[model samples]
Target: MITAQTFKRGSRPRPFLMGILNVTPDSFSDGGKWDSPKTALAHALDLIEQGADIIDIGGESTRPGATPVSREEELSRLLPVLKELIPSIDVPVSVDTMKADVAEACVALGASIINDVSGLGDPDMAMTAADCGVPLVLMSSYGDPSTFRTQTIPGDGVLYAREKLAGLTEKALEAGVREEMIILDPGIGFGTSPGQATEMLAHSSDFSLGRYPVLIGPSRKRFLSHAFPGKDPDAATAEACEIAASSGADILRVHDVGRAAERF
Candidate 1:
């Protein structure tokens, strides 16, 4: 349901919910819960029923210190689920990947969006997105999952995010992606500290890249847990969603799609 008109900047759109469907055994939040195709498909359907506007499917875990999966392994895990789920879903389907090959394959298999948490770090990633003619969620991140956790945090997190996203916006545009197909994410926990993440959330609107829509994914993140000790991560994630909605986020990527939809 996300289109070029739906992503206009300078004006906030009715916040749309992007449900997370991780078909991996090592994702930080719901590892091993929906690793199978049957379970993953069922969970995705449930999310759509609960009001998810988009379904983001990921085969690899981008958790801190996580081991990176091979391109073939990632393809193995995702293609099976996407092959079946895309044909059945009513809303748009996105593939969460940083690999150019994986992104290309998924788009060919009917994915509408490519959510790259690495901010187009891969040289071919931007080109793949352009060739597919799908929207790309380029997050402000220093490196891949294995190295992002150890990257240096800027003293001014909001400023750092804005600058990084600006540079990435140019990269995406130069690679031939249409301006409206680029969505910017601040990469809340990728390399940010607890305070840094909070700062970015507080200033989400400032991180927008010209006319590009902003997608905020603070769902069940470690920074949220660190902010409220002993509090339920789901509750914290919901609170973050509320903040993001008010701060000009056009799309919210989350695990609890129903709750986020209600909050938005």
Candidate 2:
């Protein structure tokens, strides 16, 4: 029973798996297949059966070069599914968004966590999470959603991730988010080259800013292709999960919860 309230900064006694459910038709992987609420709910249930500790629902695709959607469009796609699915699932639900409004709405609808990939790019996002009293999963990304793929590399991957995440943690705390409720993530493939992504993953244990728990999402990412070349995405993702787990990641967001959980 891993719930949003259960995870303290570094208090996770076991690795937790967050199953990803993309409700967008343009997601880089497994898009269109679960765009509808009915299908998305089914997939979420399946992930739970597969040992997922939480369900992360995303309406817009944030893949490299992905077309950005309007706030209204993102809400339209997410609210219906969330409204229908939250009550049915036993585990906590997390909304993946960079918008404060969306995060607020999802929290009102019973979502337990806000998984912001843009590192709280929206100034109001931090307030929304704090007001909701839910955990905020902040990823390390210095670019906006549109240009995240083309951001300039600062320096060494691990150091860059640490600095960026440390900055974001300050922003979150300044916005009134409690220190223990903040979780840090080194955005694995969000704005990093394949080599950089690998470097970040290898050093995920160091992403923590003081007491913040570290989360890593390297599931089926394009960066894995650099290592596996032509290996199966599932196998590669499982390997990535194992590495992340061993490197001190408290949580892992992945497409295959069963396989990822097994690595722990």
Candidate 3:
């Protein structure tokens, strides 16, 4: 079980809220509206008021088929917002990036967590997190944004994700990252179909694999779109998030904080 001390070092034994702040022009939801530092900070504060435990800020759009942004462009978009919000927000700040440079910079700027969707496939990423001594949330994905959805895996999608995450966790630990400083996310909708995502959520315990806390992000995903074709995608996404929280996930990464908090 994850204790308070472990959490302080950054691990959660129970479900926690991780609010999303996408600082990109092409993010699937609320992209340009919060792209600027002022608006982003305001939105982050609003999420905090609505019961968010952590704020995950991301500059690049990692939605499938999305083009990669340059490091300079990503940093320009993220640092300003992070600089403003870090001082004002009461909860931990997580920078969502796969690049080692960006991760290092964010850690230096008082961010406590590194949410890497690449699972530290970039060799320097794990070393960077270890060097900075911050908690790292490693999400399991088959590939990068460019070709992730094209990759094929054997067995159930949730089990495949779990196996990949397990391997990454071992690699990260071996690379000098403390065990307590690591968290696992199943990467819902990253490379799986709508049915696969649902199956993963239904059998989330399988992803736990062992004692590590599982972090789930089901907010505003394409899977939710397919799950509720006629209803509002946003609403369906929030419902999916609620299901994840109720199904033994340790953290819920969401865009609609108010609705999510109400559901919780």
Each candidate's number of clashing pairs is: 0, 0, 0
- Please report the TM-score between candidate 1 and the true structure: 0.94
* TM-score head-to-head 2 vs 3, winner: 2
Q: If ranked by TM-score, best first, what sequence of candidates would result? A: 1, 2, 3
Please list the Cα RMSD from the true structure of every candidate, rounded to 1 decimal place: 1.9, 2.1, 2.9
* Stretches of candidate 3 exceeding 4 Å from the true structure: 1-14, 148-154
lDDT scores of the candidates, listed in order: 0.85, 0.84, 0.81
lDDT of 1 by residue, 56-152 (tens): 9999899988888899999999999988898887888999998999999999999999999878768999999888888988888755576666774
CA displacement after TM-score superposition, residue 202 of candidate 2 (Å): 1.9
How far out, in Å, is residue 54 in model 3? 0.4
Tens-digit lDDT track of model 3 for 224-263: 7677677676688777876776677777888887787777
Candidate 3 clashes between residue pairs 3 or more apart in a chain or in different chains: none
lDDT of the structure predicted as candidate 1: 0.85
Per-candidate TM equals 0.94, 0.93, 0.91
